[model samples]
Target: MSDITNAYIPPAALTGSMRDFRVPGGIDLLGRTEGFFKWQNLRRQNGLWPFSRATEDGPSTVCSAQDDSGNKMRGVNFASQDYLSLSAHSGIKATAKEVIERCGVHSAGSPALVGNTSYSVKLERKIAEFLRMEEVVLYPTGWAAGFGVIKGLVRSADHVVMDMLSHSCLQEGASAATNNIYQFRHLDNDYCRNILTKIRAKDKENGILVVTEGLFSMDSDTPDLVGLQQLCHEFNATLVVDVAHDLGCLGEDGRGHIGMQNMLGKIDIVMGSFSKTFASNGGFVACKSRAVKEYLRFYSAPATFSNALSPVQAATVLKAFEIVESYEGRAQRDALMANIVSLRHHLRGAGLDYYGDPSAIVCVKMGSEGLARLVSRRLPELGLVANLVEFPAVPKGAARIRMQVMANHSEQNIVKAVEILKTARQQAEVEFEDHKRPAQFEARAVA
Candidate 1:
């Protein structure tokens, strides 16, 4: 061998070794030892810590479940939009079962082409009557209905006015048509009027479609329906109210927001989801006139291409709707409200940072990605699962967890969840204050 002093190690050999070990700081002798030790510690910490897994493998609370080391952790299902607990209802199940037995699985064709099942037609008629409209069209999903209705009604020359916080589907459907889409402040009728006036002044020939939701899903707030309807009429704008979150939970008879406000005649188009109150999958666009119905049938792409609601799905949703329209149906809605009020009182009394609105949905504003993740992990340990929404779903710094109140969840469950939230927030405050990052947790402060 040549003199040892002339020896050299190839960079490629070192790189290969480093890649094998995955040592941070590129595997300098001392750094390699430190990195391995750090890796081991992290592995142990992660192994012992709470990670949600959907499988029935670990202790679960309201928000999390843990599987094995290599599996994806399961999230507690507070993110679901099922409001009336209809999906789990016995009557809906029985009806669906019967339909499946009688009509088979799918309708197997598009409604416009050949797939107009008897159940689908009846459901549409029932939905129309429920919304106090003369004609309605069914779609594959609520988003499909939303997309079809917006794209069908608005023209390139028309101005579409939507709530700033409207769903992505509504925004996308309108935006795809033209850049003339105007978004007004959430529930601000005055803003709507001013924008409509401006649009009418400059483009008299253009039509205006004023769109809003019966319930603002995020904040659990209601729109100023009476005021909005008045503005729409005065400005020649057709009002389209999307009742996805409110269909089964609001209204006296659970007919939805327009029913509660007694503005059924004032609204031009009413769209809703069967997934929520009806306890099934599909959506409908209820309108007062056959002309609009005929136009929607011919023009709406979603209605044209989307499969007709399966016979089973239609039957299930119809049964749920029947329940919703009955006296007992009204009781369920009232019970849901009672639960909401009880939850609001409990959360406020516990100094929890919940939105506390008197609606079907409640939001607990937890600040920071780290804290939201931590709480989400801890919540399941307490036996309650909720949704931990972080950046992108909301704003960067405004992470929150949303919960929907259903007739299925008991007062005890609500109270217990609030208690756990209080304890969790108190623990977080102590930890974050010690770490000098207390400002990252304003949600706890709001509590």
Candidate 2:
């Protein structure tokens, strides 16, 4: 087989009798599926695929996780996005149980049908009040909110300009919404402005949508919301900001990136997910006009077709909103910031390359995919759990271990996780070196 073919085919596929099958051609849908399986197999061989490690306990500082081999290991969890550590809060749990008892487990139907309960309405009101928006609409999941909003508002005649590194849901929504989709460089307001100006020159009639995230989870970075808003106004475009990663975690009263940037109530639309800090699985979109909210309610697929947010989830998020607006929430945010600072300091002192600003997430650069996968596999064994981000998720050669810090993580837990990570890095480097030497020797022998 040619080296290119060998590079594409996984080691497992090349073993045994499977190597006899011819490689697929073209980048069609079937070919893409075949490529995905091939890549998945390669990741599996390197212990990088099947990343859904089951957690025994809820989102906490530490939890019991099952590895790929089904072996349970208790460790400091740096993989969860529970920024305020509210997912395991006793009050949230109790509220969920009470709501379930009163309203049953399911919503029973779509909100347009029989699903809009008093709990849902109350939660919507509370969220709108917290964000200072005129109205709020809830969705079954964050992905649905992103997808449904874009698909609902923008048609094929409309145009969408998004950040290059926006979440997949936003990108998918844009793709589904319009044919005219443009992407600016990550966080590059000038590039976005240029794109908008160029598009406006040609299509002055169609609606234009500019989409971005309040905080990018992978890079743990935020955009210049004020600048983006200015550009949108100048170019006559609507701006939508997704605060899934920042809301309920940053800014005073958890108003998130918009508040931090002092652009709250300035953007056209604001959306966020509850799973991060609200200790529940759902999402919402807030807007200034009741007309927009009503339009989305009738046009959005999730609102019109999908089942509504369950009563239990609505109640949990409502209680979470109450807590987030309280003094206790400020204290939790302070603790989370402290943990971030502590972990970043340790990482810097160790002479490691990390990315992004101070937030709940800290990404330790690994430089290569092999090193990242190896280190990630070793972390579970070292009593630490972190997420390995590599190619496709991030640009090639920018692999890293993304660590999420929680408000509940003790100083000891932070320090110990850093120590364990250092050890894992060393072990992975040694193993990588050992593997590279053998592979090099075999290649030279074949040559």
Per-residue lDDT tens digits of candidate 1, residues 127-225?
Answer: 887777899999988889988899988888888999988887788889877779999988888888889989988887778888999887777777889
Provide the global lDDT of candidate 2 against the true structure. Answer: 0.83
- Model 2: residue 177 alpha-carbon error in angstroms: 1.1
Tell me model 1's lDDT, rounded to 2 decimals.
0.72
Every model's Cα RMSD, please? 11.6, 5.2
Model 1, residue 113: what's the lDDT?
A: 81
Off by over 4 Å in 1: 1-79, 431-447
lDDT of 2 by residue, 1-447 (tens): 123212322334212222223355565746545755665556655455537678887767888888565767788989898889888788888998898888889998888788888989999899877777889999999988888888989999999999999888888889988889999999999999889989988988999999999989888899889999888889999999999988988986788888888876778999888988888899999999989998999998888899999888889888888888889999999999999999999988777778998888799999877667767767766789888887677887788999998999999998899898898888778756654665764664466
Candidate with best TM-score: 2
